[model samples]
Target: MRLMFLGDVVGRSGRQALVTHLPRLIERFRTDFVVVNGENAAGGFGITEEIAEEFLDAGADCITTGNHVWDQREALVFIAREPRMIRPINFPPGTPGAGATMLTARNGARVFVANVMGRVFMDALDDPVRPLEAALDYHRLGSEVDAAIVDVHCEATSEKQIFGHMLDGRVSLVTGTHTHVPTADHRVLPGGTAFITDAGMCGAFDGVIGMDKEEPGRRYIERTPGQRMTPATGAATVCGVAVDTDDRTGLANWIAPIRVGGDLEPAVPTRWETA
Candidate 1:
């Protein structure tokens, strides 16, 4: 099975780039399932029902979010009915929507996807390990699901890497998000899970993260919020990771980064299979 996981989508530039490229990328790569992080899709804050639908329409089978998942008030209501979208699993038990869902891929393979948030440098929530353990126990790969993915939306690279190692040999991929900057490490762990500290944001490369430079630049010096941050309206590079999993073990056999447009050098990985 083949899968694609994209990092945070920041504001308009990210949304546009995703809507435009996702379909083409799916076809070019022959991906079976796609999961996108859309927490920042709405003006670099929360995602809306409309934006979630847009992502679904553009080929994403599931959407994952982080701390900003509820920035939009409407999300609280709409998310109850939208099973394709998932928030951080570590959110208090009563949180409106679930953190994991079983979805059928385009090729008819069952795919299980979960989202986990880190406590380090962020909100303190339930331990991710337990929820992850429970989810995997219920949706055992190779037997119940054809593939599994865990999006570690975290601030610390170590936390993300720790989650990656914990799930190694059990899940198909463990990709990180929250930090807009992409990491250099992209490799299949010794246990066969594909891991990356961050998948990077799909937005302007010329600004602070995805926000315009002026506001953040001033705040860094003045230590005060002078103006609200807005998404940078500039050339954007869509970024993500693609992986091919073993059909029997549901573990990654091949992995590569997918970066396109904007200031970054283009990288569309070679196909996973030569035959």
Candidate 2:
């Protein structure tokens, strides 16, 4: 099965870009499933119900979130109802939204999508590692589920790398989010797990992690802060990763970065050519 995992979608700019071009990209790639990180979709804060619906309308099978999952007040209620919009698994026990879900692919394949947040430099929460193990156990990898995709919403590259290595050979793909800058290390791990340090943000590439540059630049230069920075209003790109898994073993066959439009370089996964 071919799965596309998009990084966090920022504000209007990110949503607009996805709504405008996602249909074409989906059709062209023949993607079977698509998961988009939407933590910042609601005007640079947490996702709102309308924004989540917008993503679903644009052909996303599931939407994942991160630290900003609860930034918007409305999310507290909307997340309770929407099973597709996932928050980090390691949030306090009473968190509104779920951290994992089993979604059916177009071909009737069961794909488990799990979302977990890292503790390193993040909000204090439950141990991320434990729930991940439980979720994976419940999903029953390769048997009860055909494939699994994990979005490690985190800030530290070292923690993300550790989680990827821990889940290697068990999950089909493990990609990082939160740090909006896309990393260059994209490759299949030794254990066949498709891994990337960070999938980047689906917002303005020119700004600081999708936020307007003016406030951040001023804060850096003047050393005196103003109001909080807002999302950049500009041409945005939908950045993500593409993973193709073997239907039988549920192991990754190929992995590639997908950066469509705006300033970043675009990429598509081709058939793996043996060297």
Candidate 3:
């Protein structure tokens, strides 16, 4: 099974790039399922119902979020109704949305996607490891589900890597997000799970993590308050990882980082070039 996991979508630029290029990506990669991080899709904050629906319409089977999941306010209610939209699994028990969900791909493959947030350098929540273990325990890859994906929305690379190692061999892929900077560590782990320290943000590369550079630049330099940061309106590069998994074992056989458009050089999995 071929699965694609996109990084956090920043703002208008990220959303536009995703809506415009995702279908083509699915076709070119022969993707059976797609998951995207939409935590920053609503103007560099939380995701809104409309934007979440847009991602779904653009072919994303599931959308995951991090600490910013509630920035939009309306998300608190809409997320409960939308099963495909997931927030951090470590949130308090009564949280509005789910932390994991099962989605059927277009080819009839069942995919279990779980979203977890790292506690280091972020808000204190339930231990992520337990929730992730529970999700994996509930859905046995290669038996109950054709594919299992875990999105570790985190700030620290160490924490993300730890989770990847912890879930290796149990899940098809474990990719990180929230840093807005793609790392070069995309590789299949010893346990067969595809892992990347950070999948990067799907937004303009020229800005400061998808926001306009002026305000952030000034604040850092002057150490003084400035106008609110806004999303960069320039061209964006959709960033993510593409994983090809074994149908029988539900383990990743190939993994590649994808960066398209904008300032970042384009990258596509060569294994799919002939497909």
* TM-score on alpha carbons, each prediction: 0.98, 0.96, 0.98
RMSD of each: 1.0, 2.0, 0.9
lDDT scores in order: 0.92, 0.89, 0.93
Q: Which tens-of-lDDT digit does each residue in 36-97 have in candidate 2? A: 99999998899889989999999999999988888998999999999888999998888788
Pairs that collide, model 1? none
Model 3 Cα lDDT, one tens digit per residue, 1-275: 88999999999999999999999999877789999999999989999899999999999999999999999999999999999999999998998989999999888999999999998999999988887788888899989998999999888999999999988899999999999999999999999999999999899999999999999999999999979799998999999999999989999998999999889989988787775
Off by over 4 Å in 1: 273-275
lDDT of 1 at 132: 79
What CA RMSD would candidate 1 show? 1.0
**What lDDT score is found at residue 118 in candidate 2?**
89
Regions more than 4 Å wrong, model 2: 270-275
- Count the clashes in each prediction: 0, 0, 0
Ten-residue segment with the worst summed lDDT in candidate 3?
Answer: 266-275
Model 3, global lDDT: 0.93
Q: Per-residue lDDT for 1-275 in model 1, tens only?
A: 88999889999999999999899899887889999999999999999999999999999999999999999999999999999999988898899999999999999999999999998999888998898799899999889999999999999999999999999989999999999988889999999999999999999888999999999999999998687899999889899899999888899988899898788888876775453
